[model samples]
Target: MESETYRGYNVWGHAILQQEAILAPERFAASGTITRNNKLVEASGVLGLFNAEAEAEQAGLAWALAWIDSHG
Candidate 1:
């Protein structure tokens, strides 16, 4: 998980590891959250699967920023 403040809102990016079988390559599930003043503003379901954790987290962050832009 990673956190950053944007436009007075706290944004969180998360990556969850997932594997279906022993031979399967590991993947990450991406999600995002937004908060203001310790209050929950929004959260996302799994955004997508990524081959790398960093990619997943970056996707989450991008989603959060886009959401903030559309809603703010």
Candidate 2:
């Protein structure tokens, strides 16, 4: 997980590890969350699967910024 402050909101990008089979390659699941005043404002369910942890995290951050741009 990574965190940043944007437009007075606290945003987080999460990368969760995933594996389908024993021999299958590992994957990452993307998700995001936004908060203000230490209160929950919004959270994404799963955004998508990504091959790299950084990619997944960046996707989540992008989603969060977009959400803030429209809603904030």
TM-score of each: 0.95, 0.95
Lowest lDDT 10-residue stretch of candidate 2: 57-66
| lDDT per residue (tens digit) for residues 24-43 in model 1 | 99999999999999999999
Q: Which residue pairs in model 2 clash with each other?
A: none
True-structure Cα RMSD, model 2? 0.7
Tens-digit per-residue lDDT, 1-72, candidate 2: 888999999999999999999999999999999999999999999999999999999889889989999996
* Angstrom error at residue 71, model 1: 0.5
Which parts of model 2 have CA positions greater than 4 angstroms off? none
Q: How much lDDT does candidate 1 score? A: 0.95
Query: How many clashes does the backbone of model 2 have?
Result: 0
Error of 2 at 8 (Å): 0.4
TM-score of 2: 0.95
